[model samples]
Target: MWISTSFFMMLHIPLRTETTSLMSSGKTLRKGVRKMKREILYPELTTLYGDGGNMLLLKQCCNDAVFRETGLEEVPWFVSEDVDFICIGSMSEPKQLLVREKLKPYKERIRELIEKGTVFLVTGNAMELFGQYIEDRKERMEMLGIFDYHAQRNLDKRLNYIVLAQYEKLPVVGVKSQFSQIHGLDNHHFLKMVKGLGDNEGSEFEGIHYRNFFGTYCLGPLLVYNPQFTKHLLELCGQKGEIVFEKELEEAYYERLRKYRHPDSPVVLGHGFI
Candidate 1:
């Protein structure tokens, strides 16, 4: 049997892991676990920072797992379906407001999923959606109210960093670029800030970790570069064994880590959307 090399190249998947995304019903699945859905929220807007790569990476990790994308004009399938994992990536401040409006109708459902321990990996400013509100110089916008955190946006100044964090024995490295800083963020800090800024440049904490949810500023196709973290999520989704594509993913991770840690290597913002 043969497959198109271009298709694999399009997904940026490794040559050996090309078949992992061919799962029926648009999923990558594991054996014996109850079937579930994984959704990408508002791809049109929240698809920045190579966040779209996160979806492709998830497909690589579990070939039988089904994947869904919620567009800006459409309601998220998770609102109606049983979603096991949700990925919300970066977006602009205006787009973030639009998301809040759309999600407001399903607030209770989201809250219920969070309470029931649904796994969510929210990257970049997308994590801002779960906060109490967002305040800029112009106005204050109310958010999901899922957490005590509130965001303050500074249109005048943008913060960018080469940040690294080790969470649960895994090396998570990525770039952070944003105009808003979270404050009054009252939630569990998932990863320690080994270097660079946290909620803001003055702070040391980096992300939110509540139950099955992991929110972070690190945005290098978050999971693709964190195989251990992805394996943990696979376990949370009921895959009770070794993760697929482990060696390839780990190799890419280490290479990136070495580049980031080397003092002589130029540290600049790579490809990022929001």
Candidate 2:
């Protein structure tokens, strides 16, 4: 039986709050899971900073996946059909506005899918589209309002960081490169910052994790850099196959983790403009 979306909201327990809790709640796929045919939706205009690699990772992991791509003018496949996963990458600041406008019409459907536990991975600034608004020195642009958060954008300055965060027992490492910082996120954060700035300079949390929807500023090659997390994701999608390059990916992940753990490693905050 499918769980009701309002029930989860009323309880205030996000589906992917923590690994242990998630497992205990029986929301995750169990051990010895079998492969299932997955339909993946890839929407257009969110490709930037090599974030498109997220989709490639999914395709590589799920051999029986059926992939669909939609342009800005075209209606997304998920609007009419049920999709197992939806992945969107980073895009330019101008493109963000366009994409937001294009997706505004389907905001309710997106929210419903997220509540139903359809896996969604929105990386980099693409995540901001689901928020309340994006404000800059020039003007304020309204967003989807699926979440209460808002973003502050500064076109002049860019913030760069190599973040090391913990998600339950897993170590998550990624690059955060953005001209904007998110605000108003509290309970539904995706990662706990162990050594880096999050959402903004004052915040300790990074990204959004509501139900199976994962929205983050961590840009580029996220899946390739974290094999364990990828494996977990495959399991979440009902696949329990071997990762394409498990050994090599784990080596790279641990090496990066080692470097990130060092005291001297830098989390560069360029200009510190919010």
Q: Candidates' TM-scores? A: 0.83, 0.82
- Model 2 ranges off by over 4 Å: 1-44, 269-274
Flag regions of model 1 displaced more than 4 Å: 1-33, 240-245, 262-274
- In the predicted model 2, the residue pairs found to clash are none
lDDT per residue (tens digit) for residues 126-162 in model 1: 8888989989999998999888888899999877777
Q: State the TM-score for model 2.
A: 0.82
For each of the candidates, the C-alpha root-mean-square deviation to the true structure, in angstroms, is 5.3, 11.6
Q: Pick the candidate with the highest TM-score.
A: 1
Decoy 1 TM-score against native = 0.83
Please give the range of 10 consecutive residues that has the lowest summed lDDT in model 2. 13-22
